[model samples]
Target chain A: MTGWLGSLRERAARITPGTLLVRGAAFVFAAGALLVAFPGEILLWPGAAVALVACGAAPALAPRTRLTTMVLFLAVGGWIVATTTYAEPVTWARLATLACLLYLVHTTAALAAVVPYDTVVAPAVLVRWLARTAVVLALTVGFAVASVVGVRVVSGQAYLVAAVAGVLLVAALAGLLTLSRRS
Target chain B: MADGSLGGAGDEDGWVPTRAFGRAILVVGVLVLLAALTGRYDLVVLAAPFALGTALSLRRRPAALPAPELSTMDARIVEGDDFAVRVSVANPDPVALDLVLVRLWLPRWVRVRDADHPYAAPVAAGSVAEIDLSGTALRWGRHDVGPLSLHGVACDGLLVSLRVECEPLPIKAYPATDPFRADEAMPRAAGLVGQHHSRKPGEGGELAGVREFSPGDRLRRIDWRVTLRTRRVHVVSTLSDRDAEVVLLLDVLHEAGESGGTGGAASVLDTTVRAAAGIAEHYLHRGDRVAMLEYGFRARRLRPATGRRQYLTVLEWLLDAKPAGGADQPSTGAFGAHLLSANALVIVLTPLLDQRSAAMVAGLARSGRFVVAVDTLPPSLRPPTDGAWGPLADRVWRMSRENVIGLLREHGVPVVGWAGAGSLDHVLRDVTRLASAPKVGRR
Candidate 1:
């Protein structure tokens, strides 16, 4: 056990400063999602904390592995179970916070997977990468917020219709990209 | 710096979706399904970024592959000198490369510090990114700095370009000569001008015994006291100062032990090359005509010349030195005895590991060429102890090598181990004494 810990410590020592920063950000985002999900529920805090720790550590250890995906699934699934069990009132601010946290986890993990732990990475590379991520997050979340406000101003049935239309539009775009692959 | 055109027509474009794309798509699909089942709009917003980020990143694919080029800045350097290698990668497509991963394949002797780790850099559209690596060239010989490999990621981590390879740049590292100096004069000086004092009768500083004044003797050399005491006209005879020709013969018949570069345990080839460089530098500095010859599978020769230019050429030639001639089929066909000057001092750098090497040394002595053999073998070399009889085999090898040296000494060939400064002093002194002695011809 001691030898294994020493080996783990040695491998961790090789991680470049840039990569360590990305990993540290991923951990903070993952843990923040859990804390927001169970704000007033004290009894469910222990299991939520364990799931949060797993989400943080998974990407740090092996970002490319499927184990990270499984841990993510565990965290998301635990959030859903807690919300269903507790008769809690949902608010837009809380939901938006949860949405942003989940997006941060996915993007950081993707960056970590491609960048090797011991590689020499320029600061501009990480900055440009984060900047692009910010652009995508701002566009998608802003559009969704506008869509929600506009739909609510109309009717209940129209809100459901807008949601279904958005899904169909995304599907059609996916189909177009697959067909254009040969050309 | 190396510069290359990117996106050649012949290159195959390898663009594919990474695992991140699949994971993002999976999370997006699950979140949407949950939104529909729970009748909650919040869940759909949670999935929106994953779906849009993937779509935006994959919207535009790179039309061309990247180009990579490798180059070294240092023109010529001796072993243990610093060198720099620059790897330049160009992104030709309109889509900016998110990250360009570059790696250099370095030779064992040429060390580019921090080249072991790969580099990740971002290149703007139609721009080039360069990685400069600097380190020491630890050992002598020709080495390549590259074959820089480049693979790029674009539009976040969704799209990856095919790996591109560049041709390697070759650099020559010359042998680092050890500090060497020899105070002894050459056995025979051949040229009319040089630092060595020759025994031939001529006008010079060093005086020989006073002799009876002859018809050709100069009046300035007259010993007035001796002439007055003996009632005979006597003149001081001075030896001529002439340049000597030195032929460094490398016996690349066999090699033993491992080379640990400069200031480390040396192999036979390492010892031979470094010692030759040292001896050549010392003599060439003193205005002696120095020449080099290899008695291996191929006879490589550099003509006798006296200058700093010749010293540089000698170092360049030694970079290609390696053990070649086999023990059984030792070839001296290319190295003819006629190539050697009659009065030149031939110093053969040999390990004496093969019987043919010893035979060649004896042959030089037989040909009446003043030859001095410097042993290139490292004394601390030990045989591999794999099994029971390893120690016994090692002992036998050492004993036989000692016997070869003894026989070469008996044959009037002076054999000595290479010890930097004054390495050839005793041997040259002995050879010079023998040259001055009278010859007894057969009746």
Candidate 2:
């Protein structure tokens, strides 16, 4: 695992600004495609755009700039989740959120691998942000997936709980992948 | 110069939190609050991984680390010589560092082919890494050894880098003489006026020929008019066999002038040394007690000695001597004092740049030594005929030199102007011929 982390770090060092831009563009295109596949998902558009911009800006900004952008990302993400809490949760909305969350995961992992370890004085702050975002995205996705599975099994309100658990599991997988790549 | 102001204040006193770390905290805190309020588990889950990564990132240290102080054990080393350097690295922090990269900078002249033992390895904390550095001192002058840079990285990826100016080491470069040249100039001991016996007999002490008395001959050497002069000009010519002490006076002053840089070109000093060395060698080989007196900032005298060792010693000293001071007049009294007892020959090798040395040589000639002034001044260093101050200065310098030669000639001293580009043999032959001429009374 350590060797893999070392390799990832080396790869990150070799990544030029051009490559970073290409990767960010690719993520955005992929998100757009997913969104187009589900036209009903209007909420995913903004989330995808924001994620793309954040990823694209990651390479140019120093570590300090990255931290500021991350803060803004968290604030917007919170507002979106809060405003939609009263409305019926849509499948498209959940998927779009998951995409944005995954984008954050990849970007953060790359940053951790690239930044010199000695330069980071406050790792806990960054770690907390990543972990919290991962857990929220996972639980939301789990709730949605479990809902579908529970309906086929029992056709009852118990599906909501299952859906939440499924969403949590997916989010957990994303977090694990991101953290593993970084380590 | 304030004590507290050195290297500025400490990290706490002038700490600026990086923008990245601060934003990371703010973002993560807001996301957590939103997740708790809205109960959006996905957002919460996403934040978890970022938090963990941030924690890991925090473990990394700042890159602005301090440099290590480096000093050498021995500063001076001769060419083709090697010496050890003791490098000490001090980590002021209480915590120990895992990996430290130290690079020592050396002068371009010195060829550091390989350092002793492991050149690159980990260095311990606050301890000295006594690495044996061995390299040939290829050239001379003061060389900068290093501004040694130290890059320290902790196990957790935090790095502290520092660069410190190391103590400088000075190496002197001395000239190496050609052994072949030394062997060719062997000394002997069988010349009149030298420390050896001479075959020539004359009134100067050693028996020469019983010649007819010449008019104006010293009465003391008359031999009671040689039996009523034998009714002919008969005189007893006794040659002095006493060892003659020859002192080679060399001028090492360099003056600003055009040196004839063409075929067979030579600098003023170059011509002087060669002439001095060649004459010294020639006289020494002829069994004369030869010595050298160098007149420069202060007069340096090597007492008369006859042997191969003494010749080599003189050559070594000549090779090491360099020109001193600006275009000031050369000191004559310094050379005159050294030439006080020299009865053989007093050869002055100079570019004849100024009046002081010329006057000194003139004084020596007046003292009755066989003063032979070998002028190494080339025509190129002479000023043009134009009536400008520059030309005037050169003319004055030349006239001063001429006056010295004239003064020496008046005292029956032989002055050889070596303007030819051939061997010292040409100049030596000229001096000998002139020295062999009969001394005429000054009109």
Output the lDDT of residue B234, model 2: 65
Candidate 1 structure, TM-score to reference: 0.86
At residue A111, what lDDT does model 1 achieve?
A: 74
Which candidate has the highest TM-score of all? 1
lDDT of each residue in B1-443, candidate 1, tens digit only: 01111234212466655666677777778777776666556566767777778777767768788888876678588888998877888888887888888878888887777787778899889988887888788888988777778778776776666667888888888888977898887888887777877878787777868899999888988999999999999999988888999999998878789999876789999989989999999999999999999888777889999899999999999988887847434345667677899999999999888887899889998888999999988988877967899888888988998899999999899999999998888988999999878866555
- True-vs-predicted CA distance for residue A44, candidate 1, Å: 1.6
Q: lDDT at B32 for candidate 2?
A: 55
User: TM-score (chain A) of candidate 2?
Assistant: 0.33
Model 2 gets an lDDT of 0.49
- Expressed as tens digits, the lDDT of each residue in B369-403 for candidate 2 is 55667777765554566765877787686677677
Best by DockQ: 1
